[model samples]
Target: MAEETRTASRARAVALIADVVRWAGIIAAVILVIHVILVAGEANPANGIARTIHNLADALSLGFKDLFNKPADDPKLRTLINYGLAALFWLVVSSVAARLIRRLA
Candidate 1:
């Protein structure tokens, strides 16, 4: 029936959206981890890979970037907190969005 077909299509659409959201969250988390590692290890910014990771992490962090300012005396702790928060933000947002999409679908 047309109704059944429409329902199936909707379900497929929702599944697709959920996959996208999950992948995006995973990517953001990975970036956050890489950024954390680079900072924690005191990676040389002049290096190509380090610079790339830093730039990508900065781009992904967007609104979450300045949530915590790193103290000059204890930069490691600050990096951990700020990047951890950014990763958490992406995880939560992506999860809630996927749940909502599935519910609506």
Candidate 2:
């Protein structure tokens, strides 16, 4: 029936959206973690790949980008805390959002 068809279509759409949201969040977390590794490993800042990843991580930081001011003696620590929180936020928020979307739809 048309009603059944519409319901199935709607379900498919919702599923797709949920998948996208989940993947995006996971990707963001991966980027953040990678940035942390690069920084911790003392990768060259002028390198293209490092810069690109740093920019992407910053973009995804969602205001947590500057959550902690760079301390005089421990700048890396600030990066770790801020980026770590952002990554965690994305993971938790995306999971909850995907679940809610699936449930509501």
Which candidate leads in TM-score? 2
Expressed as tens digits, the lDDT of each residue in 19-91 for candidate 1 is 8997799899889989999999999989999999889888888777777775857887787788878888888
- Residue pairs with clashing backbones, model 2: none
**In terms of TM-score, how similar is model 1 to the real structure?**
0.88
Give each model's whole-structure lDDT: 0.86, 0.94
Query: What local lDDT does model 1 show for residue 89?
Result: 85
| Candidate 1 residue-wise lDDT at 100 | 86
Best-fitting candidate, scored by lDDT = 2
Worst 10 residues of 2 by lDDT: 70-79
Stretches of candidate 2 above 4 Å error?
Answer: none
Question: Candidate 2 residues 58-77, lDDT tens each?
Answer: 99998998888877577688
